[model samples]
Target: MKKTDVDVVVLGTGNAALCAAIAAKEQGASVCMLERAPKSKRGGNSYFTDGAIRCAYGRFQDLRAVLPDLDEEQIQQISMPDYGEEAFMADLLRLTDGQTDQKLANQLVSRSFDTIQWMMKQGVQFTVNENQYYEKDGKRQFWGGLPLKTKNKGVGLVQALFQRAEALGIDIKYDAKTTALKQEDQLKKLIVEIAGEPVEITANAVIFACGGFEANANMRKTHLGNEWEKAVVRGTAFNTGEGLTLALKAGAVRYGQWDGCHAHTTDYHAPKTGDFNKPGDIYKKSSYPLGLIVNVKGERFVDEGADFRNYTYAKYGKETLKQPEQKAFQLFDAQVSPNLRKEYHLPEATCYKADSVEELAEKMDVCPESLANTIRAYNQAVQPGPYNPAIKDGKCTKGVCPPKSNWALTFEKAPFYAFPVTCGITFTFGGIHVSPESEILGDDKRPIAGLFAAGEMVGGLFYHNYPGGSGLMAGAVFGRLAGEQAATFCNRTKPLSSKS
Candidate 1:
């Protein structure tokens, strides 16, 4: 049996948790961070992230002098076009159906730049680039997304944050799981858990920075649906949604539960054989456009040939629920093979070559006769169809764009490749309810005593869709807010009488 005490107890050693600990310690609070996974890998999901905390608004006006490549106008475009207090509020309302806590959402987005600069002051590396046509004004900006390329200094920005957290003397505990809530007088108190034996830690605040549930199959099935449960766990392996479940069990409300893990096309089976091939993540250029995406009944759904700004795999997930199996196909002709094989090696790309469409359909596991007939009709389309008369229209699941727009290959060009694609989830958008000051809000809409929450556990923080890399950005921003707010809360108010 062992016991420890601190002003704040943070769960997880990931970026969110680490950032919270770093911020808390800097704010003159004794901080301790816990990790449920192995410390060697730095808690999977966050460690492998593309590592750029996407922050919009306010360009680095002075940096342009040294880096001539990035200009002021180009930087502005990279940020979300609809940025403001109103945009933040509206986004939460639209996505959460007016259930989001508007105050907290505004706080997180407003303080994003401060969090970024704080990380920089702590010796974190970053790159400044002008994202031409990325958003409004094309203003020059910093590399909030590309952390690995910073002056060739580090592998990831979050990785550098981890190093900085360690240097700041924040207690980093690995393989520690917070199992129960230590409630005093019906108010949330310190986190209680057992590592190897009996252990308890006393703290004025506990932050659930542990990631959302995208890895645990049962949790995924329960939340997303039975079929989607089998989806390949794409986020961090350590993110099994412990905070989500634990908070709910403790009467915590939820937000952004509907916002799911989204992805586009990535061929797992076919990889390039060159020395320059690199593993991809949220940043890599997708190997789409080279394939014709089709729905279950051997039908073209979207326009299939358009720019995919936010085209995600979640679109397909919605369709898979209505179809026989969670499935979709990318059809490509010989002309596309070189671009895919030579340029971007698609994983698990299946090649089907036959004299007739029916034979190719048979090899692809699609409706052999139905697919053949559909192809024949499509080839003869006079009025032009996603233009076939047969087969039910495709289930254009995730994208807001036309499906067939990105899908080409008329099947008139024989010898095709059909790669099966899936809609896998990554991180969950739902989280613990809070106010901007990192104060946890109860059902009564008041602060939950001295308790607080931020990071992935932030409920009602996001309005509608995520604004690019705002997840990590918000984590750093709000985590800092929580630490400082909690510190101020403790400073202004006298210590409680042995409650927690």
Candidate 2:
């Protein structure tokens, strides 16, 4: 077996791992990153995202710090309300039903803006999130407390991070899977498999930022229930719980909601696993809030207008999976068709359009009569009010079982459309416990020396539901924390000059 030594070893090459490697390198530590996937598929789940990151920005100065190109002319073109730290914290706690780990939640919310700034300093570019905004009165109005994204989504984010990593001379090894972790004396030893060969890597400190077990069918069945085994994976297929398993073997304790995950409505025909060719959340169908969703039985399962898509989308997939055939249809009329998200307009989208609701139902393989009745009931129940998608207009539905609480527009128009969708699990919420400083804790509730965790590997920040764009924010914040803490530990235990 080939043997190597490094001051820091980072597992996984996603946003978190890359951030960890970069921060460690900036701290004057010799850093090495090990990616489970091949070089062609390097970025893990981060590459498949839309790159939207949620953070607290109470003023334009905060946004300017991250989006340096924002000028007075651009600021005048959009309506971006301030997102305060209190609002961000409230959203986190509200989505998790107050089950989130208070310490981790506070850490994530407080350090979010600073972390975004740090990422910008590390060569990542930012742009306003156009998807979160709706054009009204000749101005784009941003809602949902999220307004930032990478320039070209996840692809751009990974490219920028990789460029920074290369510029820093950080060693990155693709196709290198860390299978086991061992603590010997004052160093951490990792058993890694590279090109079918075993290699021994010893590091002063190790950070696991790989991900969760969202892509593993067996693990999904075991943890997230049998229904999840059939759930489509919305991200990388390489996250099979190896990192968590290895960490547990090293005596790390498990934490968070093991049976919960960040699942959402995706096109029914989307690839079982994410398609690298069609990256950046192209398969997602988040416009249901602009319309209604019903199962094959033509029964509405959830209140599509219960809240903004950002808050409700993550938990709706489980409802879809509970339906027969684990599929549902999102229905929209000509009145709101133009307001639908760009994902709905994709040529590859599983869309059924017709002149009438009955025809649309027939095309969607649903009971035509049942669907027509459901639509009729919904239309009659819609309370008369000014329709507005920019905010919660409270244009609700009356006499409906699952009432549309906002953006209620009667479906009395031609060209009705329906989109078939299913559950697409993004990442699991459960993982090993870690301190606010990103140090992994053992079964005895003490930090394990030289072992830290970040990204999806460090859970307890999420529970039943998730706020959109917060996942990447948490990854960057915790990844940077883990990297700095690991580097400080490395320097404290072993002098950099002594390592060869």
- TM-scores for all candidates? 0.72, 0.98
The candidate 1 region of ten consecutive residues with least summed lDDT is 271-280
Tens-digit lDDT track for model 2 on 23-88?
998998999999989999989999999999999988756687778778888878888788989999
Candidate 1 lDDT for residue 319: 47
- Cα deviation at 48, candidate 2, in Å, is 0.4
Error of 1 at 31 (Å): 1.0
lDDT of each: 0.55, 0.92
Model 1 C-alpha lDDT per residue in residues 1-500, reported as the tens digit of each score: 47666667777766667677778778777677778765654544555444434543433453333234555564544332323445444443554456556666666666765666677676666554222122213432222122112222223655677778778888877777777776564233444444555476766666777877767778767766677666655445677888777766665676655445443333323221101123224222234444556666787654444432222333443443344565666666665555452223433334456666677677767788777665555544423325211112232323323334333444556566666655545566666677777777777767766676767777665433444455667777877777777666555543232335
Task: Specify the highest-TM-score model's number.
Answer: 2
RMSD of each: 7.4, 1.1
**lDDT, residue 170, model 1:** 81
lDDT agreement of model 2 with the native? 0.92
